[model samples]
Target: GGGSSSGGGGSSSGGGASAPAPGPQQPSRPAPGPAPAPAPAPAPAPSGNAAQVAISFAKAQLGESYILGGAGPNVWDCSGLVMMAYGAAGIDVGSHSVSSQYNTMQARGRLVPFSQRQAGDIIFWNDGSGFYHDAISLGGNTIIAAPKPGDVVKIQGLWGGSDIMPYVGRPG
Candidate 1:
C-alpha cells in the first residue's frame, strides 16, 4: 500500500518517538548513532525595529528624482518612495495608491480627530474629493516625503492643508 520504498511492511513497529531501524533503503549515509536534534526554526523579523532600517535607507537616497507614484532607485512618488524605503527594512507595505495606502493604515487605527503618532506610522489625506494622499512620520516636526511632482524627496513641515497624517504602525 505504501509507495515503492524498500520497507518490508508499510507499518512501523513503534508509533511516536521510536528510533529508526537501519534498513538498506533507509540507508543513513552518516550511519545511525545518535540522530542530531532538529534545528530550531528562525524567528520572525521584528516589525518594531524594521522602520529604523527603512529610514536609514531612505536617508541615503535623498536626491532621487520624484516620479508620480514611482517606486525606484530612479524616480519615485510620495508613497512609492516611502514604500521602497520601508521595503529596505524588510517590511512590505501592501498599498500603492493613496487611498489604498490609507485603507491599509486605517485597518490599524483612527484618524480625523488625530491620534498621537510614533515613528514608522502612516498618514493619509483626502484632497476634498476622495482622491488619496499620504506621508510617513519622521518623528518630531519634520516628515520624510516626496512633496509633489518635480520636487525631489525631502523632509517638509507637516501642517496646513496637508491633511494626511500618521497611522501608528510599528516603526520596525
Candidate 2:
C-alpha cells in the first residue's frame, strides 16, 4: 500500500498499493555554512634602480649652459643632456643626435605609451620627418633638458602636450 509522499514523513500504507520501492536515499546535507573569504589582492611590480639614478644625475646638471652640441660636465644640448643622464645610470644611449637617439631607443628599448612614461625614460619630439629633440623625464610631468642655444639645462614642465612627445623610451 502507498500514500502520497509526505514531507519528512515516511510513506504511509493506505489503498493497499505497495509503497513504490523506497526511492533511492539521498545523503544528508550539512546545515548551512558561512561563505568563503575572498582572495588577497596582487602586489605591484618592482620598479628598477637605473631610472632613479638617471633622474638624479639629470637634476644635478640644472643651470648648466646650453650649447649647440654640448654633452657634459658644464654644458649640454637637448639630446646631450639625456645621453649623459643615461650614461650616469650606466646605460649607453648612443650619440647626441635626436634622430640617432630615436633609432637607438626604437631598436634596443621599448616605446612606452604616452600616458605611462616615468622618470628617466627618454622623451623625443618629432620635427615632421623624424625625431628632432629629446629630454630626460624628471617625473611628476616635468623634464630636464638643454632646451635651446640660449637656454640653460633646466627643469621645465612638459610643454606642447602629448603630441610633441610622440615617443618615450626606456633604456633598460
Candidate 3:
C-alpha cells in the first residue's frame, strides 16, 4: 500500500514538471522584444509630411523610361509620374491625363498660384490648345518630369513660358 501511495505522488510531480517547461519559454518571448524595434521604423513614414513622402517616391524613379501612358513600377508618362507620386502619399489626383489631373485638383480646391508653388506641387503645361504636360515641383525652379517618349525621368530646371499653367496643384 505504501508503494501504491509513492507511485501516485510521482505522477503528481510529473504534472509539476510540465509547468517548468513554460517557464523556459517565457525567456524566448523576450526575443520578440527586438521585433517591436522594427515597428517604429514604419512609424516615421506615417508621421512624415505627405508632400515629402511623395517627393521621395518620385525621386526614386529618376532615370526610368517614359511611356506615353505608363503609370508604373518602371516607366511613366508626365501625368502618370505625377499621379503615382502623389498616390504614394495617399492622395489621388485622378486619371493618367494632365488635363484630368488639373481638373481634379481644381475641383478639390487644391490649386495654388504658381508663384506660391512648393515642393511636390503638380505643375501642368498648356502647349497651345490644352493642358498637355505635368511634373512634380522640387521647390524653387527645379522639377521632376518624365518628358515625352524616348526620354527618361529626370530633374530639370522648371520650364518657363506661356505654356506653363498659372497655378500648380497642391495635393495633400
Candidate 4:
C-alpha cells in the first residue's frame, strides 16, 4: 500500500507542475500580441547603395582639417564629419551632436550592434563622462574620422576599450 501511494504522489506532483506551466504560457501568449505592434515602426530598410554613398563621401574628405563645429567643404569635427557624410546619402541625422546622433538612430531603430557594423555605419565613443566622438565605419576594422583639432579626416583602425559604444548608427 505504501509503494502504491508513493507512485500516486509523484504522478500528482508532475501533473500539478505541468498544469501551472500551461497556465502561465497562456497568459504569456496574449502579452506578445501587443509587443509586436512596435515592429512596423522599424520596418524602413536601408537603401541598397546608401552605405557606399555615405562612405565615399567621408573617404573623399580624407585630408580635410578638423574644426570644432565645422560641417564642411573644408574643416570638420567628429560629429560634423559623420553628419555631412550621411547627409550626402540623403539621410538627416537630426543634429551635429554626437549623443543626439546616437539617440536619433536608436529611436529610428537604425542602430546596429557594434559587432555587426558595416561600411558607413557611424561609431560613437564615450569618454567615461558621456559620448564625445564619432566616426564612419569603412567595413572590416577600419574607420574614417576627422580626429581632433589640427588633425585631418583620415582612415584609421577602429577604436576599442570602454570608450566605444555598444552600437553604431546605420542611417541608410
Candidate 3: residue pairs that collide: none
lDDT by residue (tens digit), candidate 2, 2-120: 97665545565454445665588767787679766785422322126878888788788889999987988898899888888888878777787988887887776466666777877
Q: Which scores greater on lDDT, model 2 or model 4?
A: 4
lDDT, model 1, position 68: 87
Mind giving the per-residue lDDT tens digits that candidate 1 earns over 56-79?
A: 776776777888868887788877
Candidate lDDT values, in order: 0.63, 0.77, 0.83, 0.83
The residue-by-residue lDDT of candidate 3 on 1-172, one tens digit each, is 4554333545344354534455345533455445543332121122238789888998999999998889989999999998898889888997889999999988877788899888878889998789889998889999999998999999999875889999988886
Per-candidate TM-scores read 0.64, 0.68, 0.71, 0.72
Where model 2 places Cα greater than 4 Å from the true spot, the runs are: 1-47
Q: How many Å off is the CA of 34 in candidate 2?
A: 56
Show model 4 residue runs off by greater than 4 Å: 1-47
Per-candidate total of colliding backbone pairs: 8, 1, 0, 0
lDDT of 3 at 66: 93
Candidate 1 positional error at 129, Å: 1.4
